[model samples]
Target: MKLTIYFDGQFYAGLVEIETSDCYYAYRHLFGKEPKNEEVLYFVNHELLGLIENKSGSATRSSEVKQRPINPKRLQRLAAKESQKTSLSTKAELALKQSYEEKKKKKQMNKREFMEQQKTHKRQLKIMKRKAKHKGR
Candidate 1:
């Protein structure tokens, strides 16, 4: 597979071979180092960029590939796909946010409970010390 990556508005076209660990990392290696986040969306073919923004999949290059006018029907389909992705991402973000808040709240509650127990133990120890002193009298 080949992809064109955008780095700060500049385009670099290269081949992306698959690996066992990570697909993105395989492509990043071609850049001589790890690629930055912004470079992930670069398209190997400039024309595909327009189609992809409205759609989720990549355009495959074939030997018989011909240059022709883009179909309006395809564009419509792509737009629909984009809308679906937006909704999915929004839901995922909300779920993650709620999970983080719950974790934080639980941690705070545990800490408060621990501190209260410590205070109670200290008070009990103080009372025991006073009783011993009174017994000596």
Candidate 2:
């Protein structure tokens, strides 16, 4: 959703449904400050412009308030940066945890199997050392 601030003497009128809004700077007198992003100045008509101030209070004045849809990719990126923050999403986190557990399960071996693997590894190292020692001669 895009927002625009209205300017006076531009030969435009207010919207029943705002086709566009602008930054006329005249509404600051009513708002007592300059408008910020996502803020709006609506024309009651071409002659009268008023600022739509967002109240900090919890109660919404209108149910028609607009909101953008949540972006899954954006949430994933944020989740990657701060895992502990929760990102209000669990898909990536749970997927990572499941994969970690599965990997650990695959790598585990019985004590005897581990010992046999170590013995084979040592034998291979011994053969390599013997070959290297002979190469100099």
Candidate 3:
């Protein structure tokens, strides 16, 4: 698991990446202002897991194989390189897009079902009114 926090024009955001077995999952969280260390720590300690389970659905398959343990000096250099880069990862971006599309599809389906129910309700009311008219009420 890795978490990258960066300023995203309008607000500060954190992108979390998790890899398990062969599947990759990513989640984004927005902080309206720059978050303090304490706040970030609290979120990670308390809410992170629940958010992951609730919001994560689709997983992107990664093709790269895991590497063997690196030399201490080489690992330090790699960490420095990573710190200098602030852009979000492409895999994370793709995961976010897929999640958005899934939500949109669900919203449209619910709207269609609601409209169908309303139509049936109106038809039932009309039938009752016609029956009352015929009985001279």
Candidate RMSDs in order: 15.0, 17.0, 19.5
Any idea what lDDT model 1 has? 0.58
> Which candidate model has the greater TM-score, 2 or 3?
3
In terms of lDDT, model 2 sits at 0.49
TM-scores of all candidate predictions against the true structure: 0.34, 0.21, 0.46
Residue 76 miss distance in model 3 (angstroms): 8.1
| lDDT at 128, model 1 | 96
Candidate 1, residue 79: the lDDT equals 92
The list of candidate 3 runs beyond 4 A from truth reads 55-58, 64-137
How well is each residue in 1-137 modelled by candidate 1, as lDDT tens digits? 44554343343434443222222222332343446554544433453444434533433344334458879999899999988884333568989988999999999999999999999999999999999999995
Model 3 Cα lDDT, one tens digit per residue, 8-126: 88799988888888877888888779899998998799878997889564567766545689899998999999999876557889789889999999999999999999999999999
Ranking by TM-score: 3, 1, 2
TM-score between candidate 3 and the true structure = 0.46
The CA lDDT at 36 in model 3 is: 98
Which lDDT tens digits does candidate 2 get at residues 99-128? 998877767756668999999999999999
TM-score of structure candidate 2: 0.21
lDDT, candidate 1, at 122: 100
Give the C-alpha miss distance for residue 3 in model 2, angstroms.
95
- Please give me the total number of clashing residue pairs in predicted model 3: 0
